[model samples]
Target chain A: AQTVTQSQPEMSVQEAETVTLSCTYDTSENNYYLFWYKQPPSRQMILVIRQEAYKQQNATENRFSVNFQKAAKSFSLKISDSQLGDTAMYFCAFMRRLNSGGSNYKLTFGKGTLLTVNP
Target chain B: DAGVTQSPTHLIKTRGQQVTLRCSPISGHKSVSWYQQVLGQGPQFIFQYYEKEERGRGNFPDRFSARQFPNYSSELNVNALLLGDSALYLCASSMRTGGYTFGSGTRLTVV
Candidate 1:
């Protein structure tokens, strides 16, 4: 079983500043996918960013980027120019690559980090 | 376009009772998955259905069961509910091997 760990329980960043949330996971599979999800007060899970283990280049989406270190089993999300709307509970999730004839899409998530972007 | 839709936004039930939650997947999406999000914790996978068939199930007990309809809509039923079952139930839909679009979730409260 794979387990994701988010060491920081809560994080706060001032508006227009940058903040990074750390996440690590335990998985023996070399081929996998990692994702960061944001859950707002409305309780809707939104996809923030994703990274493929086979790709060394980090994934970037607008103001969100991930530092994926496969060897270290660490995948971190960096939020730049943060806004108040960015405040939410951030979760790190892991999913193994789809095997032949397999439709496994289950995501194992971390405990989540409550992030507040103060203005 | 409307995202995933979950019905009965919120419900309250007592122990030993039964409850059913409903979800409708986005158009053209063939896979629907269910998750339970306890307060202060991330969502946990409960079940996954694709093409009206059960594809995978999580560690939840037999008390938790779900089925998908021909139109890709899904229903999750809990028989003999417990207080610990109180949580936000989320529904996600996706094309095969694609990213998921999640619904706002139905809040289930068991007293």
Candidate 2:
């Protein structure tokens, strides 16, 4: 079974500053997918970034990016030039490969990091 | 143009009562998945349906069920609801390979 773990329970950042939330996972597969999701008080789960396990290069989107370390099983999200609207709970997730050993197209999610952006 | 949408933004039900949540996927999307998000936690997958067939299911009890309609919409049903069952029921749609677009979710509160 694949499991995701986010060590930070809460994180705070100042407007225009940066914040990095740490996440780690345990999986036996080599080729898989990792994701970061944002949930605001509005209760919407929005995708932030995704990383392919096989890709040695990390993924970046506008101001959001990931630092994926395959060997260490670490996938941390970095929000640069953070805006107030970016304040939300961030969840780290892991999806196992279909043919590897299981069939749960399901994403194993961590307990999430509650991020609050201060103005 | 449209994204995933869910109904009954908020609902309150007592323990042992049945609850149903609805979701409409993005147009032309063939896959719909359901997740349960409890307070202070990330969403947990409950079920996934494709082409009106059950393709995958999460670690949930038999009381939890879901189905996808011909139009690609879906519904999640929970029987004998318990207080622990109170959560935000989220619906997500995917095209292929499980990169999902999620809805705002239906907040279900079991008393």
Best by DockQ: 1
Which pairs of residues have clashing backbones in candidate 2? none
Number of the top candidate by TM-score? 1
State candidate 1's DockQ: 0.67
Model 2 Cα displacement at B12 (Å)?
Answer: 1.1
Cα deviation of A66, candidate 1, in Å:
0.6
Candidate 2 CAPRI grade: medium
Query: Worst ten-residue run, lDDT, model 1 chain A?
Result: A96-105
Tens digits of per-residue lDDT for model 1, A1-119: 89999999999999999999999999999878899999999999999998988899999999999999999999999999999999999999998643347665788899999999998
DockQ of 2: 0.58
Model 1 pairs in collision = none
Candidate 2 Cα outliers beyond 4 Å, as residue runs: A97-104
After superposing candidate 1 on the true structure, give the runs of residues whose Cα lies further than 4 Å from its correct spot: A97-100
